[model samples]
Target chain A: AQSVAQPEDQVNVAEGNPLTVKCTYSVSGNPYLFWYVQYPNRGLQFLLKYITGDNLVKGSYGFEAEFNKSQTSFHLKKPSALVSDSALYFCAVRDIYRGSTLGRLYFGRGTQLTVWP
Target chain B: DVKVTQSSRYLVKRTGEKVFLECVQDMDHENMFWYRQDPGLGLRLIYFSYDVKMKEKGDIPEGYSVSREKKERFSLILESASTNQTSMYLCASSPPGYNSYEQYFGPGTRLTVT
Candidate 1:
């Protein structure tokens, strides 16, 4: 089974400060990780993904995530936080079910981020 | 731009009523998925279709069914709407092979069962 965990239910950060929303996962074989952001009443927007190679992956809206195989973690990061950055964040892992061609994703519970001015 | 549109943004229904949630994607992707979003559950897959008339059960498929008569359209059906089944439903489509790693999502439909 493949699953992602977001320990924090909510994270608060000041404007211009670096922020991180932690995520950890468990999966068989190589892991494929992704991050997405959702604003109120809107669908989730893809942020970034980590398949292989470089540990750091940059994504939309000045956001990035570090994929650590040893730690089984893919934590979302941003150097500067803005008030508008407040939204819901989700971490997901790709699961290619054995004997199946279609790919499936397992997502974490989600993290509510609040960036204050 | 890859556009995935749902039939409605919000809906209200009575228990035991049959409901249909439609999703159409213009990207011509080979895979389409349905998921329910709850506050603490994040997103749980309900069903997915990789080709016309071909569907697969997902992590949570009880009380729900799916249809894919055409390449670009995927529909979710609730045989009997229950209060506990009320949720925000999301539809997504992804290309085949390598690019399938990412999925494009629709605006989502919020369903309320009373």
Candidate 2:
């Protein structure tokens, strides 16, 4: 089974400060990690993903995530937080179920991020 | 731009009534998925279709079914709407092969079963 975990239910950060939403995962094989953000009453937007590349992956809206294989973690990061950055964040792992050709994803419980101005 | 649109943004249905949630993607993606989003539960997949007339059950498929008669459209059906079936449903589509790593999502449909 492939699963991702967002340890923090809520994270608060002041504007202009660096912010991180922690995520850890457990997978049977090499992990394909992804980050998505969802605003109220909206669908999730893809932020970034880590497949087979550098440790750090940059994404939309000045966001990035570091993939650490040893720690089994893929934490979303931003150098500066903005009030508009407040949303629910989710970390997911790509999963190809046995006997299935379609690729699916398993997401975390989600982390609510509040960027205070 | 890859656009995935749902039939409705909000719906209210009575218990025992049948419900249909439609999704269409302009990207011609080979894989389309249906997921129900609840508070604290994240997103649970209900079903997915990788090709026309071919469907696969997902992590949570009880009380729900899917249809894929065409390549660009997928539909989720609730046999009998229940109060517990009320949720925000999301639709997503992804290209095949290597690009399948990422999925494009619809704005979502909020369904209320009373």
Candidate 3:
């Protein structure tokens, strides 16, 4: 079975400062990781994904994530946080070997990110 | 822009009543999914359909059912609405064969069971 863990329930950061939200996963085969952000009363928006090849992946809204194989982690990062960046963040993972149709993702509990001015 | 639209943004229903949540995507994607979002639980998949009339049970499918009569439409059904089933429901669609293809989401429908 595949699973994801977000160690932090909430993260606070000053605007213009770098922000990091930690995520870790456990899977039997190669992992397909994804990050999504959700605003209050809205649906989740895709941030980025890590399939293969690159360890560092850049995403929309000046966000990025680093995939660490040994650590079994994929932490979301933003060099300069904005106050509007405050939202709920989710980390998800799936087993690539299980085939595409079976691409059911295991998601984390979610991290509430609050960017202060 | 590709649009995924849910039929309602908010709904209130009585317990034991039958409810239906509809979703439509204009991108003609091959895969559509239904998920319920609760505080601290993130999104839990209820069901998904890869093709018309073909559906599969997701991680959490109890008390919920789905319909896919057309490629662009997917509907979630609650046979008997319960208070515990009240939550924000999200619909998503994705293309086939693309391992990295991202899932596009609808605005979501918040359902309240009395």
Candidate 4:
């Protein structure tokens, strides 16, 4: 089964400092990885996805994630943290090989990121 | 902009009551899904329908059921609402034949079972 794990329950970072939210995935064949963010009382917003190509993929709100196949990880990163960036982050994996499971996303437990001033 | 809309933003119900949460998408999407979000747990898929009259169970589909009679509408039903069923229910839709498989989500319905 395809799955992803977000080890940290919460990550705290100071404003102007770089921040990272860790994610590791396991899938059959090649993986389709994704990162999504959810603000207070809002549905999740897609941050980025790693379908193919570059190891490092840029996403919305100046965020980027590196798809490290060797490490089985796709960690979200930002050069600088902002107070508004604080939210819940989720990592998901999907099986591209068709059948009944097509387009179904298996999500991680989620990590709450807090950026302090 | 692609739009996915839900029936209610918030709903309160008593235990054992029947409940329905509806979702409609305007982008002619062929896929619609139902997910429940809880603290710590990001989003758990409950049910998904790829087209009218076809449904598939997700990782957690117990105590929940879904209907997709129309192309654009999907409905989630809780036969007997329980306290454990209280959660933020989300609906999503995705266009078919897209390489990215990017899904558009609705704002969600917060359901509270008393």
Candidate 5:
């Protein structure tokens, strides 16, 4: 079974400060990781994904995540936080070797980020 | 750009009533999925179809059914709406292949069962 966990329910940061949302996962085989953002009353928007590449992958809205295989973690990061960046963040994981699963992703409960201006 | 659209942004239905939620994707994706989102549970997959007339149950598929008559459209049906069925329903699509992992999502429909 593939599963994702977001340890923090909420993260608060000041404007211009760096922000980080933590995520970790468990899978039977190699994992395909993803991050998505959801604003108020809106659907989720893809932020980035880590299939097989460098440890760090850049994504939209000046966000990036580092894939740490040893830690089984993929944490979202931004150099500077913005008030508009406040939203709910979700981490998802899929086992690439599980063809029987049909590309299904297991998602975390979500983390609510608040950036103060 | 991939665009996934849902039929309704908000809907209210009564208990024991049959409900239909529609979704359409314009990117000609081979896989379509239906999921229900809750405040603390994130998203749970309900059903998915890999091709026309082919559907598979996901993590949660009880009391729900799906239809995919065409390549671009998928519909979710609630056999009998119940209060516990009220939640934000989301639809997603992705192309078939091992390399294609990200799934594009619709804006979502907020369904209320009274």
Candidate 6:
């Protein structure tokens, strides 16, 4: 079974300051990690994913994440925060071998990021 | 562009009534999924269908059923609607492959069962 953990329920940052949202995972095999964002009364939108390759992966809306194998973490980062970026973020993981099984997704509780002006 | 459409943005129903939530995908993807989202729980899968007329149970399948009469349409049925079933229901679809292709989602239907 695979599982994802989002350590923070809410994160606050001033506009123009760097921001980070932490995520960790526990899976038997190599993990297919993803980040999604949801706006108020809207569906979730894909942000980025980390399958393999460079540790650092760039995503939409000026967001990026660094995959740390040793730490078992995939933390989302932004060079500078924007007030418009405030929304709910989710971290999800899937086992490499399990394709699209019922247990494919192990999502975090979600993190509400608020970028203040 | 891949487009997934949900039949309703909001629905209200009474207990014991049968409810059907419809979803359609235009990408001709082989896989369609139903998920329910609640506060603090993120998203939990209710059911999935890989092909037409082929359905599989998901993490939380109790009190829920699915039908895939066509490749592009997947419907979720609540046998007997209950207040516990009230939540935001999301429909998603993805291509059949090994690579990590992101699942396209519908706007979601917020069902309120009373």
What is chain B's TM-score across the candidates, in the order shown?
0.98, 0.98, 0.98, 0.97, 0.98, 0.98
Q: Model 3, B15-109: lDDT tens per residue?
A: 99999999999998988999999988888989988889989888899999999999999999999999999999999998876463588899999
- Candidate 5 DockQ vs. native: 0.65
Model 6 alpha-carbon drift over 4 Å, by segment: A96-103
Q: How do the residues A36-109 of candidate 4 rate in per-residue lDDT, one tens digit apiece?
A: 99888877788899999999999999999999999999999999999999999999997642564457788999
Relative to the real complex, the DockQ score for model 4 comes to 0.59
lDDT per residue (tens digit) for residues B2-112 in model 4? 899999999999999999999999999888899999988879999988889999888799999999999999999999999999999999987765464677889999999
Q: DockQ of each model against the real complex? A: 0.79, 0.74, 0.63, 0.59, 0.65, 0.54
Candidate 4 docking class: medium
Better of 3 and 5 by DockQ: 5
Models sorted by DockQ, best on top:
1, 2, 5, 3, 4, 6
Provide candidate 5's TM-score on chain A.
Answer: 0.94
lDDT of 1 by residue, B1-114 (tens): 889999999999999999999999999899999999999999999999888999889989999999999999999999999999999999999987744799899999999999
Q: Model 4, chain B: what is the TM-score?
A: 0.97
Model 3 off-target regions past 4 Å?
A96-102, B98-100
Tens digits of per-residue lDDT for model 2, A27-80: 988899999999999999999999988999999999999999899999999999
Consecutive 10-residue window with the lowest summed lDDT within model 2 chain B: B94-103
Better of 1 and 6 by DockQ: 1
CAPRI-style class, candidate 2: medium
Better of 2 and 3 by lDDT: 2
